[model samples]
Target chain A: MSPRDPSPGAVGLGRRRFLKTATAAGISMALAPLRSAYGQAGAPGDAINVALVGLGAQGRVLMDAMLKIPGVRFVAVCDIWPYARTYGQRYLKKNGFEVRAYENHQDMLEKERDVHAVIVASPDFWHAPITNDCLRAGHHVYCEKMMSNTIEGARSMVRTMKETGKLLQIGHQRRSNPRYLVARNRLLGEAHLLGRITAVNGQWNRAVSADLGWPNHTAMTPELLQRYGFADMHQFRNWRWFKKYGGGPLSDLGAHQIDIFNWFLDTTPSTVIGSGGRDYYEGHEWLDNAMVIYEYRLPDGMARAFYQVQTTTSAGGGYFEQFMGTEGTLRMSENPKYTTINREAAAPPWDPWVSRHFLAPQKAPAKSDDDSSGGSEKVDARETAELAGYYLPVILTKAIHQPHLENFFNAVRGKGALNCPADEAFKSEMAVFKAIEAVESRSLVTCQPSDFTA
Target chain B: MTESTNTQSDCGPTLGVLLLRAWLGVRAVLTGIEKFSDTRTLQVPLLDAAGKPDSSGAVVEVTQKFYSLHSYHAIPDSMKDKFAQEPLLPSLLTTSYYAVLGWALIALGIAVLLGLWTRASLFLMGLLYVSLTVGLILIKQDAGVAWLAIHVALIAVALSLCRHNRFTLTRS
Candidate 1:
């Protein structure tokens, strides 16, 4: 018999007790820093033994980050196809790292019992099951984002993370990047720099590209391919476009920006409405282009945010999130090149902010002498302010992945909390999947507090 | 608006400090460019004892300019003997390393010249100069002390002027 999707019920209850448990876990770890926190076997030189499940694209990126970091050792790698495993193993071996390779994750997990953590980089559908099995086996996990393809499966991850009390870091690496931390914690949280953020806009636009490809390798037997639910190499390579395996571009790409929208706002969106279809890719199960709008009810009043994901062309711009407030607007992107903070012309001057080093000041572009509006048109005293655009400082300079990987490894070693924990990531899943549902239902979907109730 | 002026004023680095920033930034640019393109500047003080801008002076790489006082020919036989004994003679001179350092100098120089993230730019540049001093010390090079002293003084001036970074492209 073929394996079916695991039951979400296997992991029970997502009560509010996580905070208390997490706090207790923190205190206990603080008490004993040298030892492992999750009652697992420790590694020599304080290095953590990490096993990876999928050696796909992101999996390789994580492996590269691991190679750079001092403490992470790749003990085992598992992949259904031979290419990923062979490439990863050869690359690591060349780098003087010795690791065992496996075709089945269960075998990898069983053989590498000493592994302190597991990084699940499989397809969306396998996220929950693999994470669930790892958590049950007492290994900490750093699963990539989109906790699972379905909300139910996503919820199961949250439940298992809570029940097992093991650290489950979802790969929203942005949360761990110091730039985002400073923007969220220092600028928005402490300084309230973008005073009373009233609206937000986000988008991730990707230029059209060729469908995913596989290296020229001897094909696996038909049964071997079917065992993993792939009918052919094309489906295996391009699984993200299939409905049965993954959410379309919205969940694939929009989840990250949508997660930021939810995060920077500090509230779960109350309503979502979106629309799109595979207008370009006729056979694609997921929408090649999607636009989702979310309404967030903030403490000050109701706030709204809009998000769009397009695969046709990146003509407009790349991915970024902009939070607009009465005083100014803060725009951030992973690329330091695009990040900027623009001030409202009429709003209170940002001198104090600049003085406090809360913001880096940029000069408004010099107006051309041919400018029409510089006239001394003594307009009304109250309405004299005009908006001017100036850029904010860009401080990020290092590779982006290293910081988050450090966070996860450090969290495992009792240093700090996971920057993007499962509970936090599931919040984004609700927003993203519901937005996908919104596109299908073609109506405004109201989200209740219970939607995030786990 | 007081906001506009104060915001501008916040970036008000002093004239002396700005000059220092520009000098260091331009030095980094030149140094970075000489790494791959000109590289002939390392022999200026040797071929032209007046330290005039000969092709050698125009092409000195960061390490060669800061160390190995002689052009490879100018080094005395005694020091050349020490060079043979020493292991790993400053590996930061790689092509990729120079390229990145050049781009960084250009970026930081532009940032300081514009008063954009002035503190970080000045702090990093100062830090880099100090690090170069340390690297020179590690390699037992008596050279670079004068440039280090000037850079150290500039770093101090940068700190003093950083709090008031006005008359530049960016602030704070």
Candidate 2:
């Protein structure tokens, strides 16, 4: 008999047959969700009526994420500019949502009084006012962060949320990212994987781009621009660079990462020192490049974080926050490709974590034969081998912003708690305010504990 | 007749052909077998000081390689995605090629080993290596392309020397 033939009366199934069945089962199991969604409606009585108050680029990003969530009905769309207003209305209509379009947010508020939640994605200056009004109107608010251009406006947002007893979720989306949560709650909090983080380095660098311009036919009159606190159509279209309407590159781009520093460190910085200048962009009101160092007082020791935002060059390895500790280093970013963990040579074995499936070991890259620049090996006698990298083994399959929006909408349904609540966000926003102050003063700015309190 | 057969077997070219067949045939069979083999690392939970099984603490054991039909299709999703994007290679064609590749390698490898139609088997094996080289080139894997180029060259040498092949299931 051939080796391939089964013995007589063999009780177990052949390996090939077993594998074929398993493969079929896996494919069927994977497709089950899509099949069921097509056959039925969303969860009963989970309807959430949401109104969007800003229809610009950021607003559209939030809308796209919200569209993927089930049981969310768009009741109204509002923007100050007619072009954005029309674009939002048309886009939502294509997505099967016939929403009321208004050029004034207050007009939409008055008409759509019953919207369960309002997403405030307006310019930084308007975040506090719109969020406060939405809270007062009995709507939960999801406001984008750098919460406001000024500290007082951000404080008012916290005060209003407390007074009105509404959930105010600030859009620091990393707090709700699955990969970040695992790194923070499990690896850092539970396992003590990185053993007393000593320092952090982060940056967001962008190559120079032209000033934003609008279609001449779609330009709003100067009177309307002035009414909305913009100097002219130039300031309105490019509000992010103007001081009156928004913060500079540091506040606009740096806030997202600086907030992560505070959250992961679990403490606000005590001092900030930095310098910045607008040497590159000719007409922009804010600094074109800024570098700031923030010092945090952890319970065990002191930790310092260095952060920079550069609008002129995309040089220093894209955007990521790297935390260096005695035992290891963790580099994290919104992009999963940038997230990685590295062990220090002196640290204890991470074999237990690997066995627990908390980490996946990375295979070393193959050495190239012709790479022969060999001076470093002869110069250092006691040099250690470079540490291997390990992945966190956590994956976020959904769009990055979707989970944060879902967290807010779920909290509105009384099923979950807000990830970045208004009070918590106020504390982080204080650090960003101080960093900008440091840049302007070109000196160290110290913070009092009470200063961060809402 | 027996003396003639003995002389043919002991000749230098016949011995060279025998050694080459042994090396290539073993390599081909093992490569085919590996396509249907896989390994998994499993964690056996460790007990804490209080005698509870700690999910975070465990002993890792790498399982012995086991063969199954599913293992044959364990190509990485990323590679499959790249292949799907290549304009010249349709996904269906790639899929069909992969489905038959392992079995073909094993069958041809056995035929070459037993000296059953040795010349024909060597030529077919060379074609298989050429096809693999094409895939490696499409993926821009320079190292893999180089490795397969060596295999194709060796197969060409083996074909040139296979006229002296003996000790076969069929006379050649």
Candidate 3:
């Protein structure tokens, strides 16, 4: 397909419409009174003034949440795009905030003296530079996920964060998610619920068409091409398809799943082995679908874990994790649902002890009044409450991001530890780095401690 | 009257056949270079396991400097190791080979698009692609698989048009 194809135009139009609707809603929300805001008041000594760099889609969402967060004020906004800058300014103005605006983050940091925290929501390539500047400037940071575009960049961020003694929270919000937290507590914390985890399976699958909004065969200027990270701006915008700027699905979506595996298992994979390519999509450079497998060994050496992620024609919406253990299996996802299937405690048919134990008194199995034929069983309120409480604040509540931001603010106030620190982010990034290497090499890629060094 | 009209139409060529003939004529004109140039030979530096140039670190250093000037995915460590073992060309020469090949491919792709020397460019690209693919396969490198696929596809398209040389102008 040529670069000038109309499909991208159609997609862009759809996106623009969505953005228009979102922008209108944001304007209305901003105009609402501060007293009625989600979070409007702060405790004594809890004041946190924040400056946002890169007011893109995710950036605006975080900003909206911050405005609603009590004790937090939006002090400054920065963006390379004029539209984003104007939208952010309007939102802030409506919220009664005299937000200082800048075309660049460096200028914003230099000018905004009262800013206690900076949020780095720029592109993958810009994360390290912006984060380093923010840390060195003595401001706590809440940088978005996929910490950096490269392994070296992630390492440097970690080192700089450590040297500055400032709070640096990596935005892997799933770490703060109540559903995942409950799953973690049940599978990892409770031993009997799922006996010594032997293996883990996880997947995040989605279906997307091949068109990315841009003209095919578009003549690219040297400067424009360089800015886009390639001679093809079409590939640049649809970066997941290219190798220069993005690492395809392995780095984009796989990072989250890998982070979950690492978090629950308390170990990074010993090695990652996988293969993927753009098999279905014609004329696209990036892989449309991929499958990866990672082998992890727990510190105790008692269990092994495996993780996989695929993005292709979706047979169905898939986002779940299965933990296989000796006694029972636990399946969980962000849907706030988990199942524990208990296996009967008995000797195997092949075991010699089965013959010997057969003569012993065989107690009748316990019976329940509830229907057993149906697979679905009602969970007691107390059990559900325990699972829900596993996540900080509560489950089934839209406060995950709020509490995560709250944690960052508390860390800045020296009252709490960061939920996802730079070191942890580096570890997560290392896993992603290995995954990319593994896919490229078609061989198992291992991560050593030295790999984390800047 | 109908018979006379059919006879006249048969005597005169259709636009589709005329275009095909013209395309074949152009393809025949550009194939002259393939007969003269020896394009089968492949040249690449040998590297050892550590990815250091086999002969010395000089080639590796030169390659690194060249890469710094024009950024490409860093040569995989495995490729470096292969270079160390084969050492087909010195580091400077190897770097020059890449520079020349990259420019040549770009030129050829443009030429093919313009239907200027289409056959010659396609043959040259095909040879380069084949040589590179063989070298990578021999060295057990996975880096160039995508490029190999693209080169093969382009060569097939160019070869399929060998019967026609009538070039279509952008406006025409």
User: Which prediction has the highest DockQ against the true structure?
Assistant: 2
In the range B110-162, model 3's lDDT, one tens digit per residue, is: 55556565566567767766766765775655657665866567466646655
For candidate 3, write residues A192-250 as lDDT tens digits: 44556788877777765665563344434556456434546565456556665556676
| Model 1 Cα lDDT, one tens digit per residue, A294-373 | 99999999888989989998647778999999887888899866788877766777775554344555545666436699
- Candidate 1's C-alpha runs over 4 A off are A1-39, A363-394, B1-172
Every candidate's DockQ is: 0.02, 0.05, 0.00
Rank all candidate structures by their lDDT, best first, as comma-separated numbers.
Answer: 2, 1, 3
Model 3 reaches an interface RMSD of 28.6
**Backbone clashes per model, in order?**
16, 0, 34
Listing every candidate in turn, what is its Cα RMSD in Å to the true structure after a full C-alpha superposition?
Answer: 18.3, 16.6, 29.6
Task: Name model 2 segments beyond 4 Å from true.
Answer: A1-44, A372-384, B1-32, B38-172
> In candidate 2, what are the lDDT values of residues A1-454, reduced to their tens digit?
0001111221233323433554677844323322232123222477888899898889999999999999899989988899999999999999999999987767777887558889999998888777877776667789998888889888888877766556789999998886787677667876688998999989998998999898999999878777777789988889899898888888888988998899999989999999999999888889999999999999979999999999899556889888888888899988877888999878888887776555667767655556677523545667765676887666566788998999888766655467999889998889899999999999999999998898
Which is the leading candidate under lDDT? 2
Instruction: Report the C-alpha lDDT of model 2 over B1-172, residue by residue, as the tens digit.
Output: 9999888866987888888888889888888888898887544433333556532323223335689978885245676787788888887889898888888888888988998888888889989988887877888878888998888787787778777777889875
lDDT of each: 0.74, 0.80, 0.60
- TM-score of chain A for candidate 3? 0.73
Q: Against the true structure, candidate 1 has what lDDT? A: 0.74
lDDT of 3 at A113: 77
